[model samples]
Target: MFSRQIIPAVAAIGCVLCAALSGVAASAQTSETPYWASISVSKVYMRVGPSMNYPIEWVYQREGLPVKVLRVNEGWRYVEDPDGMRGWMAARMLARTRAAIVIGEGAAEIKGEGNASAPLRWRVEPGVVGELGECTDSWCEFSVGGHHGFIEAERLWGDGEP
Candidate 1:
């Protein structure tokens, strides 16, 4: 009789534990972050702290440079650049534009489609910055310096597909 009573109690505890675990898993999934953005202006200062009184750590001159926004604090945002430099920047200096960095050696072919045989649109060199567009399968539409086409997703470093 004690075993029968204890089994139901144990099963109830297991169910509660499972529910708690699932809740934690859901919270973790929802917390995925460090969203992408780009510099809105031609020049901006990356500060050591979130306020203007803080010392400037770096000065960025590129208007379309991509940065990963780690978090927001009042009027400032903590960001990481393509070179992995982390600093606080004025939130107004960043924009929602999606951009990507060309990786690997040699130039990446900007094709007309996702296939290797697709018409060549442009040749983007490694480290080139480009605006990123829709991605499907293993390719994404990329435009850099007036050249627009599709590039293999593996060669890009921003938005979807790692």
Candidate 2:
């Protein structure tokens, strides 16, 4: 009779241990905020607060646009765009894929290499969004449309450490 009672207790403890281990694995996959992310869908609404009940503040139609995630609460993320606009968006609307937007007063020249003296591959205007590849301190590999080239790191908002 004592052995039967101990068996149930042991099984209960084993189930709790398994649950705790899985929780740790899930939390490990969660990223810290103030990292870079991009719009994953063609349309996403930025709300005044972290919930759907909050008023819509902005409606973004551009996919792949980079946003700096400043905070995470529940399933929402507080983010800031390249233009310095800040708001809360659903976490599912954003992707972990790296991207960047051209910034500054005029078009930025995309060169064949990371050097200014390298051959020119294209010219991208401010606000153009593209996938970001490997980056050094001064330059990053960028691709948009079907064009791929190296661009000065300073010209992009989503460059540098995440």
Q: Which candidate leads the pack in TM-score?
A: 2
- The true-structure Cα RMSD of candidate 1 reads 10.2
Model 2 per-residue lDDT tens digits across residues 62-158? 9999999998887888999988999999989999899999999799999999898999988999999999999976999999998999999999999
lDDT of candidate 2 at residue 3, scale 0 to 100: 100
TM-score of each: 0.76, 0.85
How many Å off is the CA of 152 in candidate 2?
0.6
Model 1 over residues 1-162: C-alpha lDDT tens digits? 999999999999999999999898665434335788889999999999999999999999988888888877767888898788999999888887999888888999999888899998778888898899998889998988787899999898875822
- The models' CA-based lDDT, in order, is 0.86, 0.93
Candidate 1 stretches greater than 4 Å from native = 1-32
**Worst window of 10 by summed lDDT in candidate 1:** 25-34
Native-to-model Cα distance after best TM-score fit, residue 59 in candidate 2, in Å: 0.4
Clashes of 2: 0
